[model samples]
Target: MAFRRKNWMAGMLLATTFVVAPLANAADRVKFILDWAYQSQHSMFTIPADDGTYAELDLNVQVDRGAGSGDTVAKVASGAYEMGVADFYSMLRFNSQNPDNKLMAVMAVDDRSALAVASLSATGIKTPAELKGKTIASPAGDASRQLFPLFAQANNIDESSISWNNISIELREPILRRGDADAITGHLTTISMAIDAIGMKRDDIQFMAYSDYGVELVGHVVVARPEYVQSNPDVVRRFLRGAVHGYKKMVADPQLAVASIRKRDPMANADIELARLKMSLDYRMLTPNVQKNGISSVSPERIQRSIDQVGPVFGVDPSTKAADIYTTEYLPDRAELQLPPTGPASSTP
Candidate 1:
C-alpha cells in the first residue's frame, strides 16, 4: 500500500506540471515601439501594460521608445519590431518608396493633425499666409516640414518664398526663442511644451495650426508589417482591444495616464505630462469625429482626401491606393471602443 501511495503521488505531480506549463507559455510575446520618447500620449500602451489589460488577452507585450515616426515605420517595415505607432503619412511615404516591404496602419490614434508652425507672439505672425518669406526651423524628416507644401498650398503661400533652416529636433524651440528663425514647424503639443520649458510664457508663443487652413489630414496610427499582421491577425485584434481599454481608462481618469508615465520615468514632470495629455485630448485625440465614431476608426472618404492632399507633396506613386496605407479590419467593434461620457455630470443640488 505504501508503494502504491508513492506511485500515485508521483503521477499527480506530473499531471500538475503539465497543467501549469501550458498556462505559463501560453502568452504570445509581442514587441511594440512608440512614435517618440516617453510622454503622456504614450499612456495608451503603458496603462494597458501596468493594468494587465494585455495580459488578460494572453499577450505579453513589450513597449519601447522610438526615434521618430519615419524611423518607426522603417523598423516595422524591416520586421525589426512587430508593431509601432507612427504618423500615417510617414507610412504612406514609405509604401511609395518601398512597395515590396509595405506597412499598414491598423488603428488611427490621433484623429486630427497636430502639425503646426509655431512662432513667438512678438513676431506678429498670426496667419498661415504670414509664413511667406520667413525662415522656418525644422528637421529634414519632420512630419510638419514634409507636409509644409500641402499647408502652404492650402493657404496660397509660395513654398519657395519661405527658406528652411534644417536643424536638429532639440534646436527647434531654442532657435525660434533666440529670434534666429522666424518660426518652427512641429506637433503643436510638443513644440508648445518645449517652448514653455525654456521659461517662455504661454501667451508669448503663437501657433498657426495646419488644420485651421483646410488641411484635412489624419495623425498618428498603429502600424505593423503586413506579413506579421497576416500571420497573426488574432494577435493584432487582441492588441487593439487592449489599447481601446487603455484609452477608455485614460478618458475616465487622466490622472491614471499620468501615473503610468511617472512610473516609467520618475524624473518626468507630472504637471507638464498631465498638461500634454489634456492638450492632446483637446486638440488632437478628442476631435468631434473621434467623439462621435469612437477612437481608432478612420473614415474611408477622409483618408482618401488626405492621401490626395499628401500625395503631391511626398511624390507618392499615383497608383498607390488609400486602402494600401490604412485598414479598419483589425479594429474592435465601435461599441467596444466608445469613450466614456466626456461632459461634466449634473450637479446634485
Candidate 2:
C-alpha cells in the first residue's frame, strides 16, 4: 500500500511541473517603436497593452517612443526593434536610397496625410497663398518640413520667398504664439498640443491641410524589415489582430483609450491626449476613402498617386518600383478590420 501511494505522488508532481513550465514560456517577445514621443496619437498601441490584447495573442511586447519617423525606420532596419509606426513617405525614401536594406508597410493607420501649414488667427495667414513672405517655423526633422517643398510646388507658393526658422518641436508652437513666427508647418494634430500645452484657444488657430491643397500624401504606416516579416508572418498577423481590436474599442469610448495612454505615461495630460486622438481619427485616419474601402487597406490608384507625388520629392527615381513600399500579405481578414461606429461621444471632441 505504501509503495503504491509513493508512485501516485511522483506522477502528480511530474504532471504539475509540465503544466507550469509551458505557461511560464508561452508568450513570444516582440518590440514596437512609435514615430514620436508618447502622446494621445499613439493610443492605438497603448490601449491594447492596457487591456491585455497583446498578451491574449501570446505576444510579450514592449512599446517605446521614437525621435522621428525617419529615425524610427532606421532603428527597425538596423534590427534594434522588430516594428515601427512611421510616415509611409519616409519609408519609401529610405527603401529608394537603400534597396539592400528594404522595409515594407504592413498596415496604414492615417490614410490621409496630416501634413499642414498652421498659424494663429492673429497672423491672418489662412491660405497657402498667404504663406509667401511669412516667416515659418518647423523642426529640421519634421515630416512637414521635409515635404514643404512639394507642398509649395503643388500650391504654386514661392518657397524662396518664405524665410525658414528651424525650430525644435518643443518650441514650434510657442514661437508661433509669441509672434516670433508668422506660421508653422506640422500635422493638423499639432493644433491640440498648441491649445493644451501652450494654452492657446481653439478658435485662435487656422490650418491649411496638404490634402486640401493638392498634396495627396499618405500618413503613418506599420513597417517591418522584409526579413522579419518573411520569418514571422504569423507574428505580424497577430499584432494586427490586437491592433484592430484596440482601435474598435477606442472608437466606442475614447476616454478609455486615453486612460490607457496615461497608464503608460503617467505624466501625460488626459484631456489633451484625448483631443489629439479624436482629431487624428477624424482628419487623418477615417477619410471618405477609408470609410468606403475599409481600414488597413488603400486603393491601388491612391497608393500609386502617393508614390508619384512623393517619389520625386525624396529623390526616389521615377523608375523605383511602388510595390517595394507596401504589402497586404499579412493583413487580418476584412471582417475584423471594420471599425465600430463613431459614436456621438467620440465626435464631441
Candidate 3:
C-alpha cells in the first residue's frame, strides 16, 4: 500500500513539472506595426532587431510597415498587436475614442519634426511665405493635416488660401507632375525618397523645411499599452536597450545600415536613406548625449507645445498634462546613452 501511494505522488510531481517547465520555456511574441513605410526616419528601430538584443530578452519580434500612425493605434487598441510605432496625435485620438485603450510611448523615433513641405525646384517656392494659393498634396486625416495649416499660418501664409489635394503618398509625385499640386507637406524621408525614385536631383526640387513653419509636432514613437507594459516590463526595458544600441550603431555606420534595410525591401531607396541619416546627424534627433550620456529625452515643453497646437483642430484639450500622454520610465542606464563620436555633426535640420 505504501509503494502504491509513493508511485502516485511521483506521477503528480511529474505532471506539475511538465506544466511549469513549458511555461518557463515559453518566449513572448511581439509584433510592432509601423506608422508608415520604413525609412531612415525609423532608423532608431534597427537597434532591437539586428543586434540580437530582442532574443536576449526572450522576445520573438516582427515589424510591419503601417499605412498610418492611426492604423497602428487601431490595431494596438484592438489587442491585435503588442506594440506599434506611431504619431503622438494619433495616440491622443485613440485615447479619446477607446475607453479601454492603454497605449503609452516607450521611445521617441524621430523626436524632432523633420517633416517638411517639398516643391519641385523650378518653382522658386523656397519659403513658406511663397506657398500662398499653391496646391499642397497630403494624406487627408493625417495628424499633419491638423498641424500643417497652423504651421502655414505661423509662416505668414493664409492657411485657407492653400488648396489641399488629398492623395496617397504613392500618388503624390504624380500630382506634382500633373500640376495638380505645387508642393507636398510630408515626412522628410518621403520627400527625399520621392526625388530618389524618379532619379531626380535635389537641384531639381525645392524643399521648404516645415520647422520654417510652426508644425512642432513630435515625430514618431514606439508605443505599447499599460497592461502589456505591466505584464512584460522586463521585455520592454530590454527592447528599449536594444533600440538605443541600434541608434548608436546606425549613426556610426549608415552605409551598412542602409544596406541592411535594402536587403529587406529590395525597392528601398538607399540615397534617401543616406540623406535622411545625414540630416538626422545634423539635427538633434539622436541627441543630448551623456556626461552625462544617455538616450536624449523629449522635453515636456516641446511636447506641450505640440499638444497645445493640436487641441483646437482635433478637439483635444490643449492643457492636458504631458504626463497624461507620455511616460519615459523604460530608458537605459548611463552607460547605454552615450553616442559614438560623430564627425563634425551637421547643421540642425
Best by TM-score: 1
Question: Model 3: which residue pairs collide?
Answer: 47-246, 121-205, 121-206, 290-293, 294-337
Give the range where candidate 1 is weakest over 10 consecutive residues by summed lDDT: 340-349
For residues 235-308, write the lDDT of model 3, one tens digit per residue. Answer: 78877787777777777778867875766677877876788677765653654422123454676677777777
Give the candidates in order of lDDT, highest first.
1, 2, 3
1-349 per-residue lDDT for model 1 (tens digits): 9999999999999999999998887999889999998899889888999999999999999999899998899998888899999998898888888878889889999988889988989999989878889999999989899998888888899988999999999999999989999999999999878976888887888887888777988989999988898899999999999999888888778899999988978888999998888888888888767777789767877888888878888778776676877789999998997876586321110
> lDDT score, residue 9, model 2?
100
The order by descending TM-score is 1, 2, 3
- TM-score of candidate 1 versus the correct structure, residues matched by position: 0.94
Q: Which portions of model 1 miss their true places by more than 4 Å?
A: 2-25, 344-349
Candidate 2 Cα deviation (angstroms), residue 328: 1.3
RMSD of 1: 3.6
Let me know the TM-score candidate 3 reaches against the reference structure: 0.84
Enumerate residue pairs that collide in model 2. none
